[model samples]
Target: MTPTTAFKVLTGEQMAALEKDGSFAGAPVDLADGYIHLSTFEQLTETVDKHFAGHDDLHVVEVDLEALGDAVKWEESRGGQLFPHLYGPLTLDVVVAYGPLHRDGTGQVQRPITG
Candidate 1:
């Protein structure tokens, strides 16, 4: 089932760019793959550990999928799980909230609050 929202993980530069430019083309891997990768709330932890490990100044941004219309696609990846892929550049307007990566006491990364 598709969730109403998804999350994108960004490095400090990328986060700053998005904030300043009001949009982001994609990360290098996203550019190579032809889409922006997004992780569901449930998939956040492992996505960080596996792909973003050792990366500094990471941030997590909450995205409103409904606002993007058809741009968001759910495709099978990583053990056959459906991940959200944005076919177009990510605009800041669709990002309802964002903040530096933070983990709860349980060690799970927390999503930034909306509003």
Candidate 2:
């Protein structure tokens, strides 16, 4: 499936730093992996369920892939799906919208509304 945009799941602290600094290098895991991990709208729920379950103060930032240029690559990841990976720092300018990550009664993360 072709995805026009992707979402970055970050901690509140990381979001704050990105907003404050105008750009973010990478999260620890991203640093270790050499690229920032991102999830498509379809992948968000699973990403949250697998990685950020029971976590609080998390933020889901909508990203414009075109704005990121060629630095964004779709690489094979979980379940053999190709996930978006950013080779460079993430600039706040590319963020379309962001909000707190919350769960619904079924325990799945509520997808953030984005423009």
Candidate 3:
């Protein structure tokens, strides 16, 4: 089966549970020092799917923040195959920098505090 994509970011508590449960198929995973970094989508999906089960109505999307231009552009542009049409349009709200940012934070090398 084709590997699924990441719909949204996850919490540290959720990440820890996935790792302990072996839901990632023993792939390399890490959630250290208040940051999460994975090598591939397969690893990411394995963790995300465990918690995301039973939400079949929701479509999982993996968005590239850089390619989509700024937040305003994302809000205005039409979504692709990843996003569900019911969402109409998408809006990206970037949070403030807090503490030390990690290399893979929010698809960029910046810490995000999305509320």
Best by lDDT: 1
Please report how far candidate 2 places residue 115 from its true position, in Å: 7.7
True-structure Cα RMSD, model 1 = 1.1
What residue pairs clash in candidate 2, if any at all?
none
Candidate 3 deviant stretches above 4 angstroms:
1-40, 67-115
Predicted structure 1: lDDT: 0.93
RMSD of each: 1.1, 1.7, 15.9
Q: By TM-score, is 1 or 3 better?
A: 1
Return the TM-score for candidate 1, rounded to 2 decimals. Answer: 0.96
Return the TM-score for each candidate structure. 0.96, 0.90, 0.24
lDDT on C-alpha atoms for all candidate structures = 0.93, 0.87, 0.29
> What's the C-alpha lDDT at position 102 in model 2?
69
Q: Model 1, stretches more than 4 Å misplaced?
A: none
Best by TM-score: 1
Q: Candidate 1 vs candidate 2: which has greater TM-score?
A: 1
Better of 1 and 3 by lDDT: 1
Please write out the lDDT profile of model 2 over residues 13-110, one tens digit for every residue. Answer: 99889889989898999999999999998889899889887788899888889898899999999999999999999998898888888668987666
